[model samples]
Target: MAPNFGRSISFPLTPARSFSKSSRHVRSVSLPGTTSSHPLLANLHAHIAAVRSWIQDTASLQAGLANIHALHAALADLLLLPASVAALRCTTSNTGDRLLDAFLLLADAHQGFQECLLELRQAAAESRTALRRGDAGRLASASSSQRRAEKDLARLAASVSAVSTKCARLNLVAVSGEEAEMAYALVEAAAASAAASAAVFSAAASMSSAVSSCKKTATFIPAFARKSTAPESAEATVERLHALEQCFDECDGACDMVFRSVVQTRVSLLNIMTPTI
Candidate 1:
């Protein structure tokens, strides 16, 4: 869904100028209702205007993105179009796209968001269906499920925390944590993906732009992508990609072992508390 911007945004591609020295030097004959001694009011007004301009610029981009998110959240909440629209309107951002393709990409984000919501809802509904049917066999064994849940929860928490605190804006001279590069790449890719989707829907997406963005995403394809950092600075990105592949392999082996250990620990504790069951 496209977000409606209530007002037109004026991008100030240039710097603000104060009244010229000659204009400032001109003596003001006080208007009948106002004090001539007060120059601060005019300055204050200029400052407010600048602030308002900034906000409008932010709204242009934020409004669209917010609406896109709303569509997904509404899908998860099992709400209709109205709910999604409401959600989108409530969200705000600092700016919109500089290019036509970017705005179209926003449309793509909306579709992806909806897909995410649908997948989440479907998974939850399936779990509920199993519970209602009393089909324990359809689920993981009790101990295994418990352990998996704990491991998953921990991984999720760590992932979220890492995203929130670890990422800083991209800088040519400065770098961040091990996963920071991936996060930056992922964010850019997500934005690009959204843009590409929008272009596909809009019938206006440039094939060249879409292809470039697609390559960025392709670099991160599962099993083939890397997540870990290598010690070398020269060709560090390539090395990191290699490390990430190793991590995925390690993940398959370690994940099972780690979860089993967690289950064993929990079961042992339960056994100590209860008589042999």
Candidate 2:
């Protein structure tokens, strides 16, 4: 059935629980099977499925980024619709606040991931230049920086996964009718998207670490032997760097889209929750 966009609807409120570290292990409320019957929600689920598929086969960075972008766009579309906005406003549980917190967490995670990519790009460029100049000291420093960036990305990915799991929980299934179903569906979809994003971050981190390992191997070769032989490891490092650079370039725009969409969705939630005279 179509959502009643024109009709006014409101839901009773439950007292919101405090968000804290202790709540991270709390299991989420189970959603009813009927929530999938909503057309917009079904569309969101399709996007979530696409993201999960890409997560499983993150062999193609381009495809992964595309799926992530689609998921975020779908979410933004769902939340911005008239009926959804109304549902958010009148949620009988604390779903609205939880969703707001989730979006904020996702926004931070995405930004951190973007910054890690930028730092990795810089390190890769420096490594290339250091190799061309045969500057052992500079190359070593660049390799260290690359490794550090990779670690940062790995940690951020873990952090995102934890936030998605903890922050997206919707408790108390007392909400009835279509509005309640929608509120639950939205949180579930967002949590799935967050998990997909974490996978992408982990992939990038692994790529960076691989390139760093190659560079370390290249650095240990004797200069005389290096002059007489083709530097296979060095060449491989360069290739990996090139591939990483390409991936980062492609991801830049996609990351921006997800960031903006999340931020806008948060703003919409805040607007609805704001007290208006």
Candidate 3:
């Protein structure tokens, strides 16, 4: 007897849970000596809030993609199989299986990316707290942790890019005619979303690098002042400050890119899951 391929996979389409809007609100932190809030610490808090928002959005996108996978599996089983064992023998190929495997790998990468984002957010929060408390040691530790998390993000981006390429070249020979065309279109949409996701990660990595550079420069400033026999030139001091400002600008630009790409990916996924009239 041929394997039963007629049964549909029963995956429930539940709406993703909404994250609390309050989580996006950054709490103001006051330094010990200053009555007013620290501006730099406040900015860090805001960055943390933005990271939290991205994490929630990515989670929703993951759920949507899972639903699409379930539907695609059902459609493949229905369209690729015929009554006779002879037909089964003729249709048996590994291309569909590989495509499905690629999808699963992509899903796993997304999960890993989410975890990295969570770690980054926590690290940022800790650094802000350390700043508020005037704990240089703790702040340095937090910065190191953030850098490590950013490294993981870079690796995940590379993985995503590889799997995305695999998905783009996926063979749909098992699904011929109109069915094949539709399947190809769906796969293309997925590929486009994956590309967008890779862009998001790349931009994020760039932002992290810029932040790390700025921190290093800032840390060296006090040491340079203490050790210097002669005072540093005014031009050099201005140049250093300019570099730090540029880093901040780069970080902000990258964050914006991530937000836009993520939104694009979500829209592509929505199209994949929704049926057209």
Best by lDDT: 2
lDDT of 2 at 161: 67
lDDT of every model, 2 decimals = 0.27, 0.67, 0.44
lDDT by residue (1-277, candidate 1, tens digit) is 2122112222133322221222112111112243222233233223323322332232222233333233222222321223222222222311111112232323333333233223323333333343334444542242233223223222222222222121122231222232222222223322322322222212111211232232234333354333342112213322333332343333333333323332332333233223364
Candidate ranking (TM-score, best to worst) = 2, 3, 1
Better of 2 and 3 by lDDT: 2
Q: Pick the candidate with the highest TM-score.
A: 2
Q: Enumerate clash totals for all models, in the order shown.
A: 9, 0, 0
Candidates ranked by lDDT, best first?
A: 2, 3, 1
Model 3 C-alpha lDDT per residue in residues 110-220, reported as the tens digit of each score: 555555555555565565555445566986887787776666656555555554456655555565543443344344434534443444455555555565664454445
True-structure lDDT of candidate 3: 0.44
lDDT of 3 at 111: 51
Pairs clashing within candidate 2: none
